[model samples]
Structure formats: structure tokens, C-alpha cells
Target: TTGNISFRNETTFGGSGTVTYRWLVNNVQVATSTDLNYNFTVPTGATMPYMFTVKLEASNIVGCKTVQEKTVQFNPFPRALFNVVQARGCAPFNLQIGNQSTNADQYEWYLDGTLVSTLHSPNNIVLNDFDRTYTLRLLVKNQYGCIQDEQSVQVSTYPYLKAEFDVANDLSCNGILDVQITNRSVGATTYTWDYGDGSPVYVGNNPSHSYGRQGVFTLKLTASNGFCSDIFTKTVSVSNTPSASFTSNVRSGCNQLIVRFRNTSINATEYLWDFGDGAFSREENPEHQYAFANTAFTVKLTVVNQYGCRDEVSATNFIAVSPPPQANIEVAPARVIKVPNYSFTFKAVTTDDIILYRWDFGDGTSSDRSEVTHKYDRFGTYKVKLFITNRNNCTSVIEEEVI
Candidate 1:
């Protein structure tokens, strides 16, 4: 199609007379008028090398004629056409767009009236969310001028499916876990589960599961809604119960007996000890002392694991402490004995298990017996010393003077 064409006369003949115009295309008279404007359609399939020409002739009343010619070259306007590929189902909608315009040198893409890309063909335009509408536009232009042709399309989008779940009662005793799962997902029609413990796969919205061993397990849940699918995972922990037991170095001893305690508890991290003598300890293994004699003490051990599982063991009257030996000395010789070689009998009187008795006669002589007879050769106020020991390796001593 050809647009309008105009001609102007700028001749000045001292004051221009009446002017006439004639327009011709390719030596053929096409229009004749006194006005300066003409409009016509250029014939299609015109060859190159100036095959068509337009000429304008102007004349005044003085019989002067002037002619002008211009070679016509036709360039058709660009047509903007495009094809859109719309993805209906899913959260991230992928769109493929292609430009099919003729004689286009540049292109622009718009989404929802906002400029997105400047390319001939743009692919994978992603959109998220559900029940939304978007407007896509393609603007194409040629290298001739600033003219542009545009085309728009409206696309409907939907959301993709997802899966999510949470677990309860994951911790249990003796490697038995009764797990209860809760599903919290949207846009899903089917669900599947992988318990990660070599167990059978489960298919449902919410399912109860059981584990046979104590360990950390990974739980997986997948949801699908025919068009898309998603997966969610979590970790669960199971603990082993703790066993509490202990041993002592010595169960019965004398006073001030230092007892060494050994803890034999399994799967225990923390320990508490009660020595039953108003004493306590937090160490795993400890040594304790019994201060008073003839006393019985009950010892207790409490253990705990990482999962807050606790166990306790106690031995009633597990320790016995005996008193030390006491030494009592007596002599049957009077202080006023006039005889120089008088014999004196010594004895020990105390409630204790006497293992040995040591007697010093104050004459550079010693003896080991409970009762002893010592003759004083010279009775000049002799001092006697007695030492006694018990079965608990405890000892005591006493002293007296004799004449």
C-alpha cells in the first residue's frame, strides 16, 4: 500500500499566476488537479532497478512548464505475530514464546504490561502461585523507522503440589519406636513414605510406624497431585535404656576404711553416688572413707543416659566398719613390796579382738602376750608399757608404774 504524496510550487514570476499540476506513474497519467496532493496504491510485484517512477508536472499562465520525477521503492510494513506455549498446572509455570513476524528486525517481550525480554524467541518464563492470570505481549519493529506492531495473550496458571509432615513419639526404650506422623501439605492427592530403617514403604496421608533397633533414622514423605510432586525429610532418634550396677573394693573393714567404688553401668553418661553416711559424690568412680566404728552403710548408684533414661541400684548395709582395739593394763604387785625379786602379773581388760599384746617391763625387756609374769630384780619404781592390736590392724597403748 502506498501513502499520500504531495507537491509544492515555489515559482515567483513577479507575482505568481494560476498554477496547474499533473501527476504520472511510469509515464502513465494518473492524476490531474490544481491542488498539490494525490493518493494511490502502488501495484504489487514491481521489480527493482527503478521499474516504477512517479512524476509531477507544474505550469503557470505564461506557458512555462516544469517537471520533477522520483523513483518509487516499496517496503511493506512489518506484521507482528507470535505463538505462546502455556503450562496450566504447577506453581512454576514454564512458558515458551516464539516470534513469527515478517520483516521484523527487533522484538520485545512483556509480561503483565512490564517489559521482560528483548529477543526474537524467549523460553521458560517461570511463574509461581495458583489461580493467577498473566498477560504476555510481543512488540516487533523494522529498521525503517520508529514504527512497532504488537500482539498480546492472556495465560491462566495454577500451583504445584508439595508434601510436608512431622513426627511424634520418636524416642522409645529397648529399641522399640512407635512413631506417629502428621501430614501438613497442600495441593496433593496422593502421599508415600520412606521410613529409612529398612522398613516397608507406606502410602497414605498419615501413617503410624515402628522401628526395631536403636539409632537415628531419616523419615521421608512425598506428595503428588498428578502434575507435580515434592519431597520432605526429617531425622528421628531412638535411645537404648541404661543399666546401673557397681562394685566396692572392701565391704567390711575397720574404722577409717577407704573404700574404692567401681561403676559397671552400661550406656550411662552421668552418675550420682550416695555413701549412706551423709556424703554424696557426682564422679563415675569414687573412693570414700568410713569415719565412725561399728557402723553399717547402704550405698546407692544412679545413672542416666543421653536420652534422659535413668537407672538406679542400691546395696543395703553394703559396708561394715569395726572399732579399733583398746589396751588396758593392770599389775598385781603392791607398790610397797620390800622383796627385791618380786614377780608381778599383768593383764589387759577391754572389749576388742586382741591379735597381739606388747609389754615393756621397764627393764629393757619386751613380751607379746595378753597376760604376762615379770620379775623385778631391782624395784626402784619401774614403769611398764603395754601395746595391743586388733584384727583390723588397729592398735592402742597404755602405761603404768610399779614398785
Candidate 2:
């Protein structure tokens, strides 16, 4: 601080005609010129409220001397001091500043090299730069412009963390459930996982796990950077296995056999049937026709679920089909028979095995034999019929006319 001092009155009391003026500060001479104004500067590194004495002496050739003295007080310099509650924390760090400066009349605060506040003790200072440092400064000045001081501190911050992940295989079937995980997180250094299946918690990234049973489960992942953490969750579903089974109305029949199949499968969503006769079907319950005679055929069934798990069953030689006997009638002794005592021989012929034969004459007489001789009482024209049955109870008939 500096100031100018002057002896205002130019006239000296009881002095000689010509006067010499001398100025002294703190008992040391600074100027001896006739100019009354003196420029005074406080010494460097002077404390606040510094006091000094300014004196002036008037002397002439007559040897008369007079002295005038005055004391001066300067304004105090301000001391700027402060403390922060916390200097380092996670992102969006909150700060509580305490102002403990002395002899200060004005205050200025700067954050990250930008002036932000002028209050002596500002509240609610928040910093949002992640993983970086900033400078917080405080400047204080006295009321009279004597001096000003400033203090600064370094504010540090940690990074903001996020947790993210994905399930590669969330679905399974056939009583087997296996899961795969993928990590896709940002600003994270550590990881934790929970499969939510009554198992131990896992600690790592991208882990594979298997469940013992079929059901739905929840999955959780936590990511951390040692100072902050985040959490993410998901759900998974599993299904049961499939079993194939079926039943038929009949196993064996004559030619042109028709069969009805009934399906009884567990945990099956789809069905396929192979009738072993160069035929196939996809219906759950189906009816089939077998046309090959005197032949046996096998049947098979396959079932599948939504998860692409499948099971198959086959019944070998499950159906038997038989051919009916084709009957032929032959009458001997000529086409015309004599009246009274006319005897005609009847014969039945077939390629298949015959269990029984029946013969019906036009004269109301019938016989149950492969060949028979019949005598008609009276007949102008007559029709003879033959019926043959195979071992499978399948029958065929033929008729012939005689005169």
C-alpha cells in the first residue's frame, strides 16, 4: 500500500525569511526539498494494521527549528483459508466448503478455472467430471483495497459404472438346461453373477451354467469399478422331454383292412406316422387303409416338442391282412338233365384256403361240402350256387345255370 503525505500550511511560525523543509517517516529522512508533498510507500512484507510516524522539520539560517509529527494506520490484509469436507469421490461429487478466512470483506470462488460464486461460504458445490481432477479456488480481499489473498485445492473424481449383459442360450428341453452369458458393460472392472437356481453365486464375466430341472429362472449381474456399481437382471425358461406312444383298434383283418390309430404321447407337440406300407401321415390320430392281400406290415410313430427334442416308437409286424377265397362253381353231366332220377354233380374251386363250402340247388336242397351230387325232383331250368369261405372267415360266391 502506498500514499502521499504533505504539510498543508506553507507558512512556518516564528521562522526566518527563508525556510528549509525536511520530511521523515518512522524517524528516517526521506526528502529535504522545498516541495511540501511527500510520496510514502509501505515496506515490503509489512503486516496488517501497520502504524508509522510521519514528521516534518523547518529550519532557516537564523538557527530556529520546529517539528510536526503525526501517526498513520494502514488497512489490514485479508487472510484467505478454507477446508473441503471431502475432496475425492464418485462422479457427481458433492462438496461442503467451510470459509475460515480473517479480515476479509469480499470473497470470490472459482471451479475448474471459471468464476462460479462470490459468497463467503457457498453451499451445494457439485462436480460431475468422471475420472478427472479439477481446481477449486477462493480469493479474499479487504474492504479498503489494502491486500488480497487466494487459496486453491485439487478435486478428484471416480468413474461412473454401468452393468449390461445378455443370455446366449436361455431356452432348453428334454430335461437339459444349459445357459451361456455375455458381458457388455462399460466402465467396469469387476463382475458378479447370480443364476437364481439355488446355486452358488458366480464371480466372473461370460460364464456358462446348467440347471438340474425344468422351469423358469431369474438371472442377475453386477458390475463395479471399486468405487461405484450397477445391476442388471433377466429371465430364462426351460421345458421337459418328450415320450412317444400309441395304440390301434385292430391288428389283423381281411383284405382292404382299415385301421384307426390313437396317439398317447407325453410332452409331445408334433407327431409323424409311418404305416410300413409306403405311406406316412402327420396327424395326431389317423385312420389308414391296407390294400396288400396276404401280407403283414409294421407301423412307426415319432413325436417332438417345441424345443426340437424328439422320440420315436415302432411296432414290427403289427398288422396282418388276409385274402378272401374266390369261389367257382362247376356242374357236370351236361347242360340238360333228364327228368326224374336226373343226378348232377356240383364242384367248388378256389385258389385260397377254404374253411367251408356251401352248395344251393334250384330244387330247394342245400349241401355243405366242397363237392356234392344233387337229384332234382322236377326242373325245366335250374340255377346252382356255390359259396366258399377262407380260414380268415372271408367268403366268396358264384352261380351257374343248368337246363
Q: Which predicted model would earn the best TM-score? A: 1
Off by over 4 Å in 2: 1-174, 180-203, 216-240, 335-341, 362-364
Which stretch of 10 consecutive residues in model 1 shows the poorest summed lDDT? Answer: 43-52
User: What value of lDDT does candidate 2 attain over all alpha carbons?
Assistant: 0.84
In the range 267-337, model 2's lDDT, one tens digit per residue, is 88899999999999999999999999889898999999876668899999999998877877767877687
| Error of model 2, residue 397, in angstroms | 2.2
Tens-digit per-residue lDDT, 1-403, candidate 1? 6667675645344556787778788788877764446565666664321235778787878888888887755565777998776536466777776678977888888888888888788775666767688888888888765468888888766565678887877667576888899999888898999999998899898999888787888999889887678899987767888999999889988889999999999999999999999999999999999898888999999998886678899999999998877766767865457887888888888888788889998899989988888888874888889888888777777999887
**So what's the TM-score on candidate 1?**
0.50
Candidate 1: misplaced stretches above 4 Å?
1-168, 182-204, 218-236, 305-308, 334-343, 376-384, 391-393, 400-403
Give the TM-score of each candidate: 0.50, 0.49
